[model samples]
Target: MTPAQHNTPAFHDLFATHPRLTGLALAPDGTRLIASGQTSDADGTGYVPGLWEVDRAGDDGIRPVTGSGPGDFAPAFAADGTLMFLSGRDPGERGGTGDVALWALPERGAARRIAHHPSGIATFAVAAGADTVAYTAALLPGATDAESHGRLRRARKDAKVDAVLYEAGPVRAGGDGEPHTFVRHADGAPMDIGGQGLAGNGDTALSPDGSLAAYTRAPTDQAPDTNCVVVADAVTGAERHVFSRAGNQYYHPVFTADGSALVCQRQREETHDTEWRVTLVAFDLASGAETDLLPGFDNWPWPGRPLPSPLPGDGTLWFTGDEQGHCPVFRRDADGTITRLTALGAYGSLCVTPDATTLYALRGAVDGPPRVVRLDVAAPDQEPVFLTAAGGLEPLPGTLTEVRTEAEDGCPLRAWLALPEGASAERPAPLVVVPHGGPQGSWSDWPWLWNPWPFTARGYAVLLPDPALSSGYGQRMQRRGLGGFGEVPYRDVMALTDAALGRADLDAARTAMAGWSFGGYLAARTATLTDRFRAIVSHGGMWNLEAFQMDTDMSAYFRKLFGDPRTQRERYEADSPHLDAAKVTTPVLIVHGGEDHRVPTGQALGFHNDLRRLGVPVRFLYFPDEGHDIGVPNHIRVLYETMLNFLDHHVLGQEWRRPPLL
Candidate 1:
């Protein structure tokens, strides 16, 4: 296919239907590679992820391994050449609509269901040299076997209890159920390993020899606010104490190659002033020794990137860390030494060959979208070998360039500028400035959720600027917005936006702004502070700081940023956007996920209500099924559609209309 076939002046279907590749899995022998990706469903209402076998050299076109009707993932090869994966193919799950079960596909036969659990399996691992499998399942308290678990569940349903007694755990609005890791040999009896795993979790790992499993146990009544990393013997179900520090949280436990150590990330608040930086940690099994990997290493694991990008093999661990505007690969040897292997761009969704000779990852930068690449172990920083054609992606709809500016305080700032074709001094394109989230995050890499390609296709220029709170800039830049999210970052954003507007091809009069999370908060704050832009959109932003402090998951974390509402009321009033909602004159679009606990739905609902009460032009979009990030494909489609429609109506002076979401 050609770029012309996919790109057009009108709404491009490519944006909605393009194949998205993620989660790569390498076979034990290094000869076969399997990948999992989501494609547009038949009804075009959602996405279904399926497994595909990728040719090592990309000679043969990628072939689909299993049908897309049922979502499949985590494809692992067993020692007996049996491939096992988790899927939601069966409708007879334990009352959960989309609960997953283990399915096996032999070397030369069709796939069939291999195992089933009452509360459904969350994650699983196949033994490398042994014929055992380990997975996590939610069993009823005081119930051992699946049958007893089911009986107790039935009794609980029959009684119809509404209140739950207090046992210390994460406070959320739902039933309090715990997931426990279970081990079993393939086609044999399963044994329950007593450790409280997170519901719908993914931080469990099984050793290569199938003798040990490492998992993160959520804090219980005894330890109210601390996560415990427990390593248990698979066959005996004997738990041992590794290393844990007070006031520290551990997660993403993976067994070392020799099965004598566990590698994971440690998050702690060393002080009350600064944000936590997750560092690599190792816990030895034999001596119960704790080793801090990359001691004093400034960089952290790629923020907001799901799944640890590196895999450990052959007594070595390899992973990605964010450093100086790039998320590169780092290798850790057994002797407590670390080396940087790759540079210059962000890397994620990584896997390594069985022999550990080559590394594979989906890499991208501000100029391009993610594409699969292969790198040699010896010299990973060398030019990458593109493994796939990336579904023959179309040519860039616009030109991408970089912009540099300095804040009033003399802090240097960087931004990425996307200008549509035919933009010139005589005909400047309308601009949309997008600030990143985390306030601690940067726009150093390409973003799938906030892709600028669509804006460029519509003859608009998108400016992604990183302000004082951005990473990769150094500690001084990070500390600039520590307790004052509304002050320093605001100045930094205005500086960069003013610089971008100075360009001959950008139209400041017709500009708009949009963002999600902290980005969304900044957009709302910007709208309240100035009337330069025509419109504003805030997706899942915190509008009321005092109210948000109570509803969010990390209440303590938010408290650390902005002090207690009673003690530091002035700061709350100074930083919050909703407290000054009456000053917001710009037309606004407020979008939020109803199930979001991070920046609760009330944040958007309250803001929209206030804007309406103040006689301001505003609209609200809510997705009940989505969480912090909108994951459902159908909701994502509507989100992209509504955002464009809102921008077109206000910024481009088109007729005001609403999308089909009543």
Candidate 2:
């Protein structure tokens, strides 16, 4: 008997059939590890997520734990070793209520729904050492119990009322009815830990003893809606503000081992001259004093739910942070000394064993998909031991190399250049410049959606440039691109691109550029500024800066970055890509998700309209059901197909044949 072999060069099938690994958790006993895996349905139009169990000792292969899936995700283990997760499976299919509910899977029996709510559970957290769970769900203003909330939900549904009424400006959407946090013991009725209204997209945490619960909420009194963290008594529902500043955001609270302090991330407000910075801070529960945990550490720390040290009540913490092109684990001891752990590949879903001797994380690089890896906590410099296989990936069809250049102001710019196989001086591969989103994010790890393999496999060279606003390069790089999107970031991108093109294996004359979100904005902006690229593609990109400043999901954050668009017209006029639509001569393919509120679909529509009226060769690919990022499996196919087709015609000098599915 033998296993089956899979074929390669299946670009469409790659996305259609590949199983994606996300979100990881370790059982209390530390013998089992669980990860959420999603695979495309038969038709590849949607994805069904399930839970998979991985052997901690790497002896047995990975196995599935949940078969009847209605999208099980956010795997976590209760202290009693019960596997807990959230699911939306239909009642008939899996005894689920068809609403997102908290389910528990005991080690000896089948999984069962433990907590049901009229409104689905948005997010949840379990105490590290107690049978306590805290979760958030939506309930109408006057509704108390599940019955009352169900009535209210029915009333709204009967009236077909899906609109969100905003009594103020900077309106946003999504995240269910109205959110509130609750806590519960094993098989006990949940208690509402009363506090200010929870933010639609904020996180919640439970103290190790389950005595305190922390959550975040947006300020109702102000326009720039930044979150403020609040601590509530799990039993009394009495709430107290932990951290709240007018222009800052405090979120993702994690309780210290002794439960006397809370460590959380703070997103500092940005001005026209400075970009936002995210760092960790600890709040002393006794005095309500805020202490900057890593004041001298400039890198952005990817804080996981902190794991206790080998000693029970030690205040030592473990987390990951980005440096250069890799994300490494870092340890902050109880004495405030910081030490860097492993020094390769990016990491996520980090967890530690109960004994605190070994640490586990999903490690991936630009050249490889993520795999489960374990490291000895005491040996910080030792290489990680692999526990699960890396996504069954073959050798990359291309070669990955680093490119470096100096920006106009002498700041160092770096990028990852992936050259297709057989690219050489005599036959240089055509180039496609891809700038990452976030402007605050880095292109350090393997990205499933915006992956470069498909393009490289098709004989195209992909350039991933980390420009001025990219992370891992420290504050100076971020501060250089603060005032507007058009100036330093754009120059940094061009600088890196030029350095890549100078190589003998990349064709400079035959090139194109594409991006998403902030990168999308850069692509659109670059199309207007340069005619070097034969084609341009912008997905979920922003065009009109003024309109974008007012309509995005985090409009207040942008408002604080750049002042009122009405009053501060200089920044809008200088940076808005829509303002120079008439200058775009390159053929353009505009892709946008109709439901995208982050960059918004309007940016695409307006850009397309202007280009069409000006007789610029333009095509618009719109997905009405998608959001800021395209998640639908089939839509993902159409996106790549259309993009490749457009590039083939404009950059590769091939005939334009639109994808049949589109």
Candidate 3:
């Protein structure tokens, strides 16, 4: 491909029109693979997802299962070779007032609506063995039936109060929405969980026999949310808690092949100072017995995903985890012998053929977008083969290079450096270092959000460093930045940045840094410590440590980090950027979603006010309609455009151009 072919499009043309590939599932026969990808009208106004059926070898090419405009997603294959998915078709035709409805497509003919509800399905599960289907729908606090729930919703809209009664912690942002009632279709019509709806994140997992269903529920309003595994009869909806411990959080429950026990990931806290360690466990229903699976395994299941793609009768369950810098897939035997199946890159949306031998997943790396790749878990030595080129993105504007360095504590750190194609020794590129969030997160995999292509397209080299808190690196590496959040991680990022700058093609003088969430907090902290960068853009950043610990929906969780704001003044003062804002000389760009409950809009407001009060050059890009992550397509476009403009002006010394909406 020509270098020019890699040219990134204009902000408007790029953000709204860029493709998205997700929801990968394998047909029972393993003859075809199903996936959902983005499709937009000529005007880009009609953005939607269309399903594709891909051949195993992709020799015959991909075939479209849906036409256009309708937002189709979450492709789940049933035992009978039926490809079931959710779509936002017309309500009159789908028999629902809400936009989205669950529809099923048989192997031979057209698709049919399997379920529809007014509140729309937040999440759903299709039983692997039986025909039972379970879905979760949003319900009011005290309502029982669909009609009363619908009426309560309408009344709230009519009253225009926009007020929520919060007698609990974690009301918004990162927290799950009010207890979604599980609507299951087993005996006859769909039914809710019980008299009191289960307070959980709708992580529904059904047993192979289709008799029992397991889901994760947050048991209380404590500072740190603890998930309790709930197992219930799929048909009767009679549920009870299983294998829960007072000091540990349990989630990601799935039934064993025999359906006699449930296997789940457990996060137990041995001490307050150390990081949480994730382990796999097998819980027997009859004896209320729990046995640890893969005893030494430290990788987090993340999002409560129980097991990787399980072959129908396969005794072992497979999964994905990060080791070193790459996210690889691994499988565990009945004896808890865990074997690594993949060597490099990151994998997601794992699906195994019913025969259980072949595994298919969406694989991506630092330089590439998401792709459908095939692997043989049984043949763990074999490398994964890219199955369908359907998810291949337009050629990137830059090339990727992996940089490695060591922290002061001797922990190995790495980062992905994306440089513009034309960048060279003579034509050095400005640097845009993007520290990742999750403090517990990593840049080891592919993600469309905070993608570095936009910056590289603008003649900038982007640095995505995997620091102390990043995953896939061992539990010991994770423990490095536990409560401090500043020492080792900061050093690792700078160490890699220093290593990257040693290259002739990168310029340290025209440098800037940007990140969101934890990365945003790091960016704010980085600015206070050093004037190494010309500009710093912090999105949903935590500048004021004390206020953030108190105001967020996860105040309880943050308290685990900062402790009591009044008592832990030393940690807060040393770590919080707001405490030392006067030391920041770099131009600041604060971007925040007003509805952000995780970081909260207050963090951005207070930081911006401080920047302005101290006479520091600052600009605020606040989206009132957005949350922690910008959901609106238009707002996303504006987000990237605004960040691009900010960097272009401050780092490249280019003529500042205002974004359209601004």
Q: Candidate 1, which segments miss by more than 4 Å at Cα? A: 1-12, 66-69, 91-98, 155-166, 173-176, 197-200, 220-225, 269-272, 303-315, 333-339, 444-446, 660-662
Best by TM-score: 2
The TM-score of candidate 2 is: 0.95
List residue ranges in candidate 3 displaced over 4 A. 1-8, 40-47, 66-69, 94-99, 158-162, 173-177, 180-187, 195-199, 222-224, 268-272, 301-304, 308-314, 390-393
lDDT of each: 0.74, 0.80, 0.74
Residue-wise C-alpha lDDT for candidate 1, range 1-662, written one tens digit per residue: 00111135343346666677767767667776777778887777777768887777867747887432348877877777677888877644322245578878776777777777865787887776788888887765677767787777678878996455434445562352567788887578888876564333546778778988777776544443467777888888798764567667787777766666777888764233675556777787788888887676676764432222234434566777766556777776656566777877777777777666788777777666666778876574667777777553467677888888888878878888988877888888889999988866777677657777777777788898888767767567767776778888888888989999999778878989999999999999988899998999999898999999888976665765677889889888888998889899999999898789889999999899999999999998888878877765556667777887899899888886676765
lDDT of 3: 0.74
Q: List the residue pairs that clash in candidate 1.
A: none
Candidates, ranked, lDDT: 2, 1, 3
| Each prediction's TM-score versus the true structure | 0.90, 0.95, 0.92
Candidate 3 TM-score over all chains jointly: 0.92
For candidate 2, the per-residue lDDT at 418 reads: 84
Which candidate has the top score in lDDT?
2
lDDT of 2: 0.80
Candidate 1 yields a Cα-based lDDT of: 0.74
lDDT of 1 at 220: 46
